[model samples]
Target: MSKMFWLSCCVVLATCFFQMPTISAGSRVHRVRRIVGGAPAQVPPADDPKVYLRFAGKAAQIKGVLDQPHYVFRGIRYGLKPSGKDRFQRPRQYFLEGDIDATLYPPPCLQTIPGDGRVIGSEDCLFLNVFTPDLPDGTEGLPVVIWIHGGGFRYGSASQYGVRNLVGKQLVIVPIQYRLGTLGFLSTGTPELPGNAALWDMALAVQWVRNYIGYFGGNPHRIVVMGQGSGASSALMVALSNIAKGSISAVVAMSGTAISNWAVENAPMITAREIAEYHGCPTTSAMILLKCLQNVNAEIIAEGDTILERTRLTNRGFVTGLNGMLGAAPNAEGRFDGRSLPAAIEQPPMDDMTQGNIPKIPILTGITRDETKRAVESQYQSEIIEKLKGIPNFMDQVLIKNLQNCTHINDAAKNGTKQSGGYFNLLNPLQFRNYLKIARNNFIQGLSKIAEATNDALFNLPAFLTADLWSKKGVESYLYRFDHISQNKNGFGHLFLRGLPIIGNNTAELNDTVSHGDDLAFIFEARNLDGSAMDPPPVLSEEDLKVCDEYTRIIAEFARTGKITIDKKPVEKFSGSNFIQIAKKPKANNNFRFCEMALWAGLADRLKSSTCQFLNALDTTVKSAENLFFDTVAPAQKNIGQGLADTQKAIGNTAQKINPLNLFNRKPATPKTKTN
Candidate 1:
C-alpha cells in the first residue's frame, strides 16, 4: 500500500466520525436509529479449547457463538479488503494469512444501518459467516443456503440475520457481507471507477464458499443462493455473474426479482458526480473523483452527503420497503473491461421468458399480501397529499383507493373538467371510479390509494413478472404469496423474515397490515445487539418460532432439491398456477389482484418507466438539510411540505437540467402476473 494511503487511514481514525451513508443514485440512504451506550463488549472465546477448521491447505479456528445444535462462525474473511490501493476495484481473494480469529463479526462494511452517530465498521469489511449444525459424524457436504441480507443496497450486513434456525434443518447456512452504498457501488461507468463492485463482492464471496465451504461442512455443489428484499436482488444478480454460474445451483429471491425497476442503477456516472459535488470532492473527472474519495476520510465519503445521511423517505425514520428503494442500484457498467451489460444479467429482471439473458438455474420468487403498507406510511403527510392531488391522474393511479372507503361524485362534478378536460381519472380506468372525491376529502384514505398503486407497480407485480419469466423460460420457478396477517406488524413472511398463524384461526388479519420486512424476524434467530450485555436474547414468540420452522424447512427442501413441499403438499410451480399461498396448507391461488397495480407495472415496463429513472431525476430536484443523525431523511425532509413541494417544484423547474427529458413522463409497466 502507498504511504499516502496509510497516512489517510491514520487521519480517518483521528477524525473518528460515526454512522456513514452511500453514493449516487438510489443507494440505500440511511436514517439510522441510534442506541445509547457503547456497543456491548464481546464475550471472550471459551477457555481456549481451540476448535480448528482446515480447508484449502489453510486452517483457522472456527468463529461464532456456540448455541446448541448449531455453531455460527462469524466475520470470516473471504476476499481481499476493499481498502488502501485496492479500494474501488473489483474484490480480490484474501485467504487466511494467519490464525483465523472468527469470533465477533468483523466491522460491517462502512455504511449507515440503524442510524447512530458513531463511526462503525471498516472499509476492509468483506467477510462471510457460517452457521453449521453439530451434525452426526461423517456428515460431509451438507446442503447450503447462502444468505444475502436486505437494506436496499445501502444498508445491512451478514450479522443482520442468523442461520441458527436454518441449520436446524441440517442445512449449512452462510451469510456473506459485502460492500454497501458508495463503497461497494459507487462507479463512474469507465475503466477507472467501473461499478457493480457490490455484485462482484457477492460473486467473490460465493467463489470463496465454493473453494472453502467444505472445511466448514457445507456442500459446495449444492449451494442455494437466497435473499430477501435487496438481498434477494443480490441473490438474483449473483446467479447472473459469469463467475457464479456453476457455483450457485438454485435461488430464492424473496420479495424482489431480477427485473424490479429499482434493481439496476441506470445512471451511475451522474450519480457519482452528484455525490462528489455534494461532498466537495474533486469532481473534475471520474479519475479525480475516484482518487479524492479514496484519499478522503472513509467516514466522510460514507456519511458526507447531508442530502442522504439525514433523509428518511417515509414516516418511520427509514426502514426497508419498495418505496424506500429509491436509492442505490446495480449497474450495467460491467467490472473492468467486461461487457457493459453481461449476457447473464443483460435482460431486465422484468423481461418475459422469451426475452432471454437468464442463468439456467432453478428459481423461486414471490411477494407478500400488502408489500406497500410500510411505504404508504410516508405518503399520508399533508404535503404529499397535496402533491398527489397535483397530478390530474392521481386517482387513476390509486383506483382501489381504499376499497373500504366508498366515494360518490354527483352528476354535476362527474362530467367536470377531470380529464385533461381532466380531473383525477386518466386513460387508465378502474372499478373504483370516485377516486377523486375520496382523495380530495380524506387524507389517510387518499394516501392509501396511492400506496396501493405504488406498491403494486414497484414491488408485487415486478415480483410476479420475474417469477413468471423464469417459468416461461422453462426454469424450475416457484411463486408464492404470503397471506397470513398474524405477523403483519413486523414482516411479510416466506419472502422476508418469519410469520405465524393466529392461535386458532390462521387467516389474513383484517386490522393487521403485513408490511415489508416483517418476515425477517420470523425466519432467522437474530440476536439483538441493541440490548445491554445483561439483557437476555429476544424471546421467540410462539408464532415466530413456528413460522421460522415452516419457512426454514421449505427453504431447506428447495436448497437440497430444486422444489418445495410443505405440510406434505406439493407446492405447485408458477408455470401451472398463479401462485401458491404460504399458509397452513400452502395451496395455489389464481384470482389475486383487487386493483390495477399489475396494470401500472405492465405499463411501466412497456413504457420503460422504472424506479431507477424517477429516483435518478430526484438527485437534482431534492435538496438536503441536516439531521441525518436522527432520521435518515431528516436532512431532505425535516418538514413534509419542504420535503415534497421542493422536490416537485425542482423537477417542474429543471427537468432539462437532467440528461433525460420527460423524467416523470415515461413508459409505464403493465406487469403480466399470470403466464397467459
Candidate 2:
C-alpha cells in the first residue's frame, strides 16, 4: 500500500496498544493543587472546550480543558506546512480555517531510517502547542516560554513534549515545530533563499507569538526561547538572528554549540544541486531546483537513508548529505546579514565574531560533566577507532594529533606531564597518548592534523567558543558542569548517573562523564510531569534526593526568575562560586571547581591572544573596572588559571567600544597611564 496508508495503520496500531484517552464533548474537568516550595495552594478545575484562535487570516483550533484560573490550550499551529513549495523556505504565516482538532498533537516530519526505507511522518508538520492557565478571553498577559526540542537536528517533534504540568506554574509554555532535514536547511544563497530557513522559521514563529500571543494570555515582550541539543542550537540562532532581535528577551541553551564548522566550510548551493539531481532535476538555478524537488514524491524524498548511506560509504571526507539533509546547520555566514545579526558561529584565526558583542540577555548555558566521554563512547568510539586503525598508534597518535591540530596545542610530547593541560590529555589521557604513538607509526605525515581537525570540529572548540561568545555579551550568564552519577545500575534508574566500573578496571571512580541528554532528566522536570519522581540510582540515599531537590529548585527558580541563588542569601559571598552542585547530596560548595571550564577559558584566551591583537592591548583598562570584572570576567575565570582573567581583562578593555554592529572595527591603542 502507499506510505501514508502504512503510516496510518502503524499509528492506529500503536494507539490501540496504549489505549490513549480521546477527548469527548463531555469530559469532566480535573482539579489539581499548586505546590510551591512544598506549600500547597488551591487551584481551580479545568472546564473549557477546545477553541479556535483566528489570526493573520488563518485559524488555529486548540484543544484544552480549562482549569479554573487557566485555560490550557494543548496543541496549536503556528507556521505553514513543510510540504509543497513551502519546503526549505522560511516559514509562511499560517492562516487558520475550520475547526482544528487541537486535542491531540499532529505528527512529526519525515526522516531517514537506518536500513532502506523512510520513517513515515507528515509534511504538514509546522505546528505549535501552548499551555496556559488563563483563557484568552479573561486573562491578561503572562510570561511566555517557547520550548525548542533537542534531537541533534535530525529527530524529535513537538508532539512528544507536554507542558500541562508547567501550566499550573503560572506561565504559558509554547512548544513549537519547525522544518527539519533538507526542508529546513537547504540554502541557495539567493535573496529568495538566504539559508538558515530553520532559523527563519523560528523567527517568524516568534513574530507570530509577538503579534498574537497576548490574545492567548502570553506576554510577547517577556518571551524566553529555550532549547536543547539541535533545538538549543536553533535557540541560539534565533537569539542571534537580526530578524529576531528585540523579539525575544531571554534564552536557555542545553548541550548546544553555536557554530558548526561543516556549515561554515561547505557551500549549500553545492548540496542543493545534488539533492535536485537526486529528485531527477539537473539544474544549478535554485528556484527551478526547488520546484523540481517540490514535485517529487514525499516518500521518495523521505528515503534519505539511501542518500546518507551512499555519502558515508563514498568517504568524500565531507559532512554534506545527511548533515545538509538535517537542515543546513548554522555556520558563520548563516548568522550575519551586513553585520546586523549576532555572530552565532565562532571561527578561529579571526575575531570578527568576537565574544564581546553578543546580545546582552539572561542566559543559561551548560554541559554535562561527562559530556565528551559520553559523546565519544556512544557515537564515535567504535567508528572513530576503526577509522583511525589505518594510521600508526591509531589511538594516541591519531586522536592526540587530531586534538592538537584543532586546538593548536603542542603538548603531546609531554604526555601525562601536566595531567590537565591538553583537552585530550585531561579527558582520556592514556587513550590519547597511546593513539598519538600509534598514529605516528602507522600513518603518513600530517596524520596528526587530520585527527586534530576531527576532534576539534566535533567537540572541544565548539563548546569553548560558544561559552566565550556568551560571556562576552555582558549578560548574567550562568555556567554549570553536572558531575553527579547515581548508583543504580538499570531500568528507569539508569537515567541517573550511578558510578559504574571503569571500562577495563574493576574499581569505580565517580563517573563524571556528562553523557548526552543526561541533563534533560534534571533540567526539564520531565519525571515530575507524569507523577514519576526523578530517582537517582539505588545507591543514592534520601539525602541525595534532597540534594537533587535543591538543585532542581535552584534551576526552576532560575528559569522562573533570573537568579540561581534566588531570595535566599548565599551563605558565602558570590565570589564566582555562585553555582550549586547536584550531587549525591545537593550542596552549595564553593570548593567545587569546573576543571573543564578552566581549560576551555584558557583555550579561549589563547585563541583570542593569537587572533585579536587589539584585545590584548586593552587589558589594563578592563582590569580596573570592578563591575565589569565581577559581572563579566569572574564567572568565566572561576577555577581557571590567572592567565585567563588577565586575557579576559585585556579583551574586555579592547572591546569597550566594540558595538554589536561593528565588532571587527578596532580603535588605535591609547598610551599607558603612569602609576606612581
Top candidate when judged by TM-score against the true structure: 1
* Residue range 1-676, candidate 2, lDDT tens digits: 7999999999999988899454343342232334667656555434545554666666666556654555655446667776666666666776656776665555666655433345656777777766776644343466788888765454556655545445655577887877666666665544445556676777877887787787676777788888865677678767765667898887776655454322232345544544555556645355565666677766566564346435532442122221222224444444444645433233321222342446777776655544434323433334443444422233332333233333322332223211121222223223222112222323332333333334333343444445444555555666555556644322111232121101111122224343445555443434321123445312334554444555556544555665566337632222332444456544455422323323322333322344333224224343333211011223343553453333333211111221222311223223222211
CA lDDT of each candidate? 0.57, 0.49
**RMSD in Å for all candidates:** 18.7, 18.5
Which segments of candidate 1 are over 4 A away from where they belong?
A: 1-65, 113-116, 309-322, 334-354, 378-380, 388-392, 397-442, 487-510, 529-540, 594-598, 601-676
Q: What's the lDDT of the predicted structure labeled candidate 1?
A: 0.57
Reference-based lDDT, residue 661, model 1: 26
* Model 2 TM: 0.63
Write candidate 1's Cα lDDT for 97-189 as tens digits. 456666676677776434344546688888888777742233446888888877667655677575667787878888888887777777676
